[model samples]
Target chain A: MKRYGEFNALNGASFQTGEDARVVALLGPSGGGKSTLLRVLGGLLVPEEGSVLVNGVALPKDPEGALEALRQNGFVFQGYNLFPHLTALQNVTLPLMVVHGQSEQAAQQRGQELLTRLGLFDHLHKRPAELSGGQQQRAAIARALAPKPRLLLLDEPTSALDPVMTGEVLDVIRELAQEGQQIVLATHEISFARQVADWVVFLANGTVQESSTSVKFFYDPMSSLAKEYLTALTKYR
Target chain B: MPNSLTRRLIWTFVLIAGASLLLYATFASVHYPWNWSNAWSYRFQFLWGWGTTLAISLGASIVSILVGFGLMVGRRSPTTPLRLFCHGTVELLRGSPLLVQLLLGYYILANRLNINDPILVGMILLGFFEGAYLAEIFRGAVESIGASQREAAKAVGFNKVQMYRHVIIPQAIRRALPGTTGQLVSLIKDSSLLSVIGIEELVQKVRIMNSSSYTALEGYLPLAAAYLIVTLPLSWYASRLERRFAFET
Candidate 1:
């Protein structure tokens, strides 16, 4: 469990992804430990208790092990924390050159290709603040994808965007999902999660309420908490 | 409508003219004898003193920045003893007056160590004095970076050194510029205090000139002008750097 001060952000939270699942979505209300769980899965945070096993290998608590796990995964934050001092192209290339030890020419080529694919070619030279919200988030995604991570962890990636910008970012993720990218997403967009996620893990009160296939969870939720949450979200739909 | 450049020039001219008028009036009211010839004879001495002051300021500025950066890193180190040592040093330097520190450093500390060079001791003391302030400025600048920035870097699999080198330092440098430049200006002015330790800098030369010429106004007015000449360009250059480093946000 992960405790922030006196509050337990994740207490006895456990679930396993399906064998054939390409995308796993964590669905819950605000402050229900979705973000904290995603962070733990990515090895960005170490829990005070419990073990995390990814791909049948237990995550070691040592710093070196955590670093190795992080290297294999890419995390996109809700706020799109792109380095403000760097342009979009530099933001993507800097990590590759500095952390991954790629040469300048190779890093630049990879950064340019990823950014162009994300529809950020025209804004590659612009800094984060100069770009629109959708553009900045796309740049952040391109930076995440530049390293060719085995698994991508995204925490509410479009929570800060307007409807149009939200649609733009979601479309990019959907395309990635369609390309058979392994992704674990925590989000509040019910419809978008329904469309993209192969498996669903519902969390509440820092505990896993239900873990099932997306078809089963959406059409016939077994847990009462999951039923209440789905009804509350679908009340107006 | 007036363009911005014309308006700025107009305001500059008015302010300068006003300041000149104020100085003239203040001097006229004194009704003192104006004998610049006696002080003018010491031009070479004054030039030498000014050059020395400039050299000391430049050396001290570089030394202080290096010390400050080291101290800031120490303060953030995981080792408790090093962090406390750095903290205590900053407090001691910032708590006491520079005059007292110089006297103690030269007369007591240097004597015990058997180092007789007054200029070197004085420069070191001045640099340490300013370094305490700069340490705090750097710490504040580094802390001002959001937690998300660090997390993002960590998510990209950056080690501590790589994170700081690739991500944190660039942003911190930009944030620290204004405060760092302000501290540097203060450093230049504070160099005059080193005259207490017989550095023979500008202020010390002015004292010698005044004692001989018995013309305080003539001797001291130029001393003030000499300091302004150095500090004004520094501040102007600082503003230019501020503009160049300014990101959109």
Candidate 2:
């Protein structure tokens, strides 16, 4: 949660998860602390009052541990921001060599295998500027997936893409969820949320207005804020 | 028409003066009492002088990048002492006159320390002198890469060292090239100053010949051509690199 100059972007907001929900979506309007909540989860923010419990440990007590948790978790941004100087292979292999303690040779080999599997083998040597929008996003997904994190955190994964490109990137995410990876995303792609998200959270003004199964959240939102937010978001072209 | 024609002529004059410089050694090679024995011998001297100048320039550039890279990394270190030390080094190098640093390094440091090798002294002084500017370019380039980039890498489980070695430093180096051309060209020109240090780099040998031959034209004209032969192609490649990184960015 963000402390934006005496205003609490997320004021004591709390959340819980089901036993085996694979894809959880934080669906919300702008300024609702969706990004701030992600920042908190990513250990980039510290609330003035209250704590975050992840994997049975309270946060901010140990900044180092919080950072480690954040590291073990993968974050995918909406912009598909890849390093322009680097090739797809180098981008994927970086974390493998950095975090996972793999040698350059091993990382290169695995990076090659991952990119080939992602259908980016041909683009392996091409810099980010040389790749198409969809290819870059797929390569970003490949980078996130390389370390094999337990929790995959995505920030509006498909917002920057056109409908066709969105479909292509979302398809990769869908395939990942099908393989039983726990996917947590802050997104505005309502269609993907409704279709693929097992659990959905509707946040407004820095608080979770509603949380329920995707079927229930869409078909019948309990809060007026959630309904209005969904209506406004859906009405947005 | 006359006024505009005068302005056009003046503009062309300025272009010639700026882009083309008269080489002192070129006239020295072929004119006056100290003229070379033949055109073939003059051409050979010219080629050798140009090659040596290129070597000096290239050598200075490589040293500048390596030393600058290390100083830049030190600037980013979290430890207070290391950071301050790097900061002080950059300030000392950039603040003091480069010529002074070169003279100081050559005379005070090298001479008293019994390091009689003038080539080694020239290399050290040139590297240290140019590294300050290079450090600034590198630091700015690395900083301009958005904080989001590093945060993303950190989240992906890469440690601080890995973040720099793999992702950040490479991008920073590539990004700094445009700003760095000034340093590169300056370094090349700066090599001429090394003649005073007794390094027989292009300009030094010409000075030796000039004093002995007593003919400015025969001793200095070819040396100037040699200098151009080294710098012109370098500036060309620097321009090409600027264009490439512009598109990449």
Candidate 3:
């Protein structure tokens, strides 16, 4: 994570957790460096001076570095950005062929299985435009979880959705939590975080403002920034 | 009704104009018409010449597409030097006139390098020229793809090449198609310029016929018709391809 410009997006951000960790939520104001931290972990961006460890080993960023980060983690975006050109099926299976070295048949089979699991079986042949917002979010989730990744990074998984669609997406997220995979989600969803987030990490101004069990963070957050944020947020609600 | 009436009027005017031109040719050629006995001799020559033009243009287009895509990829490379080199190659090709490139490629460089095959040189020359333009088209399409798609692909465990091959290129190529097809038509027309280098394309062959037979109308009329016949269907097909696809929007 070496950026040439002025801002340090992830200033002194640090965390450590178990291998099968589930739902550690990154709560933040916009441009608070939470997404940058995720990008560093995703190996899409390299930090100037930080070591990202997975099971106590340094994540590599060399030839197979991005692929290596890709291997361990699946990233979900707020926008549910599926490829408009490809059918839902092709979008899911593409990485299987390119990185996992799966045969086309295997990729297709796996893609079908994943889409089916996400309740997108009937929607598999249609392009993203044909899907509802929730369906597209599920498709994005299916694409992420297709390889049974060890860790998942979700950036504001429900930030852009309507209230009904947000609930729909949160239900899927909860279902994933029940399956026992590690997920670190960056979100603006307050009550949903209280319900499902195992731990809540309030990040603001490029540093960790507070990290607490979801109960304590919602009921009695320590940091002034977290307190102010939750106050401002709940005021709107 | 108005649109249909305008269309009918256009067709009527086109047919009348064509008939008048043909009648004028009949008189101009009456003094020395294309002798039916001699038609076969010249027709075969025209066929061979036109075939060369088509081959050159098509071959050039294919080469240009592959090369241009490679250049686009290189331009998008993370390493600065590689990106600079790709950018320089694009700028160099776009800046120079294709005619000058043709001369340099077919005569000067080919001779200097001891490359005797004019056909290969000609194809490379045309392909490289068209490729530079196609590179920009491809680059724009690639950039236009939502960063979200690339992120999604990467998030799904695709490396850079995988992201490009699986996600980016397919989407980019689709958007770039109609524009490239239009470019291909222009490339086909541009192939006639190769005749200046003694490649004996349709235009050059027509010139030979005009001089040899001393019947400008007899020679030029059919050649112009041939060029139209070859180009029109292609242009019309390109128009369909531009409009028919749903993914473009």
Candidate 4:
């Protein structure tokens, strides 16, 4: 449980991903603890109680251990959170050289390759503010993927973008998913989640409402909250 | 139509002319004999004093920034005792008047320590007095960086020192520049207070000249101009730095 003052952001929330799951989509309404759970799972935030085990390794209670766990997973925030002072290439390369102990030449080569693959080749020298929302999010993804993290966690990566931009960013994530990169993303995009996710974890009121394979969760949701949520979300379409 | 440059020049000329007229009227009404020659004879003395003031300001500026950074770090330290000590020092320095601090620092503290140089005591006291204000400025600048940026740095595996060196300090410096420059300008003005300790800085020299020439206006006008010469360029350079570091949000 994580207490943010009087409000409980995550209260006794528990869920697990399948061993072979490639893309686990966390689905919930706004302020339903999806983001909190993702942060905790990535070890960016330590819970007030209980423990998180990533690949059978318990997330340590100490800050040093928590940081070590964080290093193994790449987290993409909803706002992109790109370093404004740095160019797109520099943002990715700086951490690689400084933290990961890569040489300048190697970091530059890897940074350029990742950015190019994300279709940001022409805008490599542009700062975060100079790029569109979609482009910034794509650059953030590239930065996260630069260190070859064991697992990637995204917290509503496209929520701040318009529909057109959202589609473009989602396309990039779909490609990564197809490439067999393990990813866990919290998202409001119902159709994209159904299409891309192998596992689904539906949360509401700071607890998991349903946890199952994407097929079972989407087609035959057992919980009333999950069924109601799906109907409410799909009704607009 | 006049472009911005032409308009700016016209306004500048008008303002200067207006200021000249105001000064002329004020001086003409005084009906006192205007004799700049008496003060002018001490040109060498004025020059020496100006140099001393410049040196003191420069030294104090460096010392204040270093001490301020150290105090800011201490204030943010995890240890309770160090944090409280730093907090108490900042409060004590900021609460008391600079004049009292300088007098007491020199008479009581320096006297006991067997430090004879008034100039050295003045510089140290002035630097520490300004450092308290600078510590707050630096702390605010560092805190203004968003939580997400720190998180991003951590997720990328940057340890505490690496995060500060690579990410936090670079951004914090940009935010701190304007305030720091303002503090430096204040530091320069505050150096005048060192005149009380017989440092023979610009103000002290002007006072000595005023006493000999018995001409307050003639002695002090050039003194005011000298201060503006130093401060105006500093402010302009600070604005240039602000523009250079500016980036779109």
Candidate 5:
């Protein structure tokens, strides 16, 4: 549970990932604590009451220990927060060299590879400002993947992109999912969630209203709150 | 582009030459009992004073920028007491007039601390005074960065030091540069305040020359011109920097 002064942002929101679920999606409305939950899972937020465990390792309270635990997760933010001062290549290679302590040559090679794979090889020397929204998000993904983190956490990755840009970014993520990368993304794109995610978690008012396989959750919701959410989501689709 | 810039430069130089000639003609023809020769004679002393001013400004600016960086870090620290201390320090220094701060440093603080070097004392006082303003520039620059960047840094598994060194400070410094240059120009002007403590800077030398020669037009005019010489190019370069770092979103 997490409290923002008097308001409870997360009220005993208990959830357990399936043993085989590689791509889990947190589906919900605005202010539903989906982003908060993703942050907690990524070890970015220390919940006031409950513990977060990733890959059987409990996230620690000490700052140093938290940094160590955070190494396992790579996050892609809604804004695609690429370092503005650095070129796309530098944005990807910086964390590898600085955080993971990779050699310059090694980091460069890895960054180049990832950027190329994301179809951004020509844009390597360009700064984030020079890239389109979709390209910037791809560079952000390359940056997140450079460290080879165990899990990827995406918080509303497509929220800032237009429909075309959204499709482009989602395609990159879908490719990663096909490659068997473990991911937990908070998204409002219900169709994308249904197509990409193996497990779906419906969150409303800081509580987990329903959790099930994506197929079941999409067609048959267990909770009335989940049903209402599905109805609203379907109306948009 | 080069040709146009060169033409502009030539025009600027022509304008300056014309202004100097006009000023010389005005003073030489209108003013009585004026010895332009006597004004030229004080060039050596004036040069020395200019050099002293430059040295003080350079030393003070370096110290000020470093102190400002430290204060920015302290202000952003997670610990409540440390953050409060940083805020209070910035507030206290900024709240007082720099002239009063200099007076205290030279008159009371220096004596209480038994500091003998007037130059060193001047640099420290000036640095601390300017640092308060620079701290605000740095703090504002850092704060202007999106919170998403900080979160991205943490998610990349960066410790605080690594995060700041690689991600935060570089961008902050870029954003702070134009403002910093402006402050440094202010520092250069403020360095004249050191004359109160008998530091033989530009203004002090001008004062001496005016007293001895009794030619306000001859002595003070060139003194003003000398300050312009130092500050004009700086202002130009700062604008260039503003354009250079103006990242388009």
Candidate 6:
């Protein structure tokens, strides 16, 4: 449980996941603990009375130990917080060289290769502000992928973009999902979740409301709340 | 010449002529004795004092930057006690008058601590006084970066040092440049107060010359000009840096 004085942000929110689920969608309403749960699972936050284990290694309470465990995952934030001062290539190259201990030449090679694959080859030398929202998000994804993490965590990656920009980012994420990247993303885009998610976890009010295969959750939701949420979400989009 | 260049040259000439007229008026109005030869002979002495002033300011600026960075990191620390301590120290230093601090450092602390080097004491005192304000600048600059940046840093598996060195601090320094240079300009002027302890800096030299030759106009004008010489270039360089960093944003 994570508490802010008296209020709880995560109250006994528990679930289990097999490593085989290539894409896990954390679908929920705003302030429904989707982001908090993603933070916990990524070892960015340690709950007061629970354990977060990824790849069979339990995240320790100490910060350094938690960081060691967190290294196995790459995270993309809602704002697509690329380093504004660095070029797109430098933003991606820095982690590979600094965190993963790759030589500059090797890191640059991998960074260039990833940016090219993301269709940012023409804009590799541009800074974040120089790129469009979609390009920036794509660069952020390349930055996360540079270290070859075992898992990827995305917190509302397309929330800051317009529809056209959103489509640009989601297409890249769809490709990654198809290539079998173990990814988990918190999102309000129910339709995108339906199209790409393998396992769906519906969260609300700081608890897991329902968990099921994507087909079952979308085609036949067990919980009434989940069904209502799906209906309400689809109505808006 | 281009029209803009010609206009600038004309303005410069007019400014020089206006300043000369003002100087002539001040010389006429002042009743103090003007021993122009004595002041001229002491020009080398004033140059030496200017050099000392530069050295002290340089030393103080370096010390403040290093110590200020430490205070900034301490203030941002997640530990409560450490953060509180850093905050208290900054508050105390910034709250008190710098002249008082210098007096305490020279009169009481020097005797108790047995550190007799006046210049070293002056530099340390000025360094800390400026550091308190610089710490605030650094804290503000660091905080100005979005919260998501830190989260992104952590998500990338960067250790604390790596995150600051490669990701955060460089940006903070760039963002804080204008404010940092402003503080440095203040530090340069504030070094004049150290003359109270017989350090013989530029202002002190001017004081000695004014008392002996009784030429307040002759003595003080050169001192003002010397300070302008130091600060004007610094201000220009700061603006240049601001432009260089603008390419990023």
Best by DockQ: 1
What value does the lDDT take at residue A158 in candidate 4? 92
lDDT ranking, best first: 1, 4, 6, 5, 3, 2
Better of 4 and 6 by DockQ: 4
State in Å the error of residue B228, model 2. Answer: 2.7
Model 6 regions more than 4 Å off: A55-57, B1-35, B78-85, B247-249
Clashes (N, CA, C under 3 Å) per candidate: 0, 16, 5, 0, 0, 0
Error of model 2, residue A190, in angstroms = 2.3
Question: What stretches of model 5 exceed 4 Å from their correct place?
Answer: A55-57, B10-33, B78-81
Per-model interface RMSD values are 1.2, 2.1, 2.2, 1.2, 1.4, 1.4
TM-score of each: 0.97, 0.79, 0.86, 0.95, 0.92, 0.92
Candidate 1 lDDT, tens digit per residue, A122-211? 998999999999999999999888999888999999999999999999999999999999999999899999999999999999999999
Between candidates 1 and 5, name the one with more favorable lDDT: 1
- Residue A104 error, candidate 6, Å: 0.5
Per-residue lDDT of model 2, residues A182-210, tens digit only: 88889988887888899987788888788
List, residue by residue over B51-164, the lDDT tens digit for candidate 1: 999999998998899989999999999999999999999999999999999999999999899999988888889999999999999999998888999999999888999889
Q: DockQ of each model against the real complex?
A: 0.82, 0.44, 0.50, 0.79, 0.74, 0.69
Q: Rank the candidates by DockQ, best first.
A: 1, 4, 5, 6, 3, 2
Position B204, candidate 5: lDDT: 93
| Candidate 1 true-interface contact recovery | 0.87
The fraction of reference A/B contacts recovered in model 6 reads 0.87
- In model 6, the Cα lDDT at residue B66 comes to 83
RMSD score of candidate 3 (Å)? 4.3
Candidate 6 lDDT by residue in tens digits, B35-134: 7787897898899999999999999999999878889999999999999999999999999999899998899998699988899999999999999999
Off by over 4 Å in 2: A4-9, A42-50, A59-64, A102-125, B1-62, B78-85, B106-118, B178-182, B195-201, B233-249
Instruction: Give the Å shift of residue A203 in candidate 3.
Output: 0.4
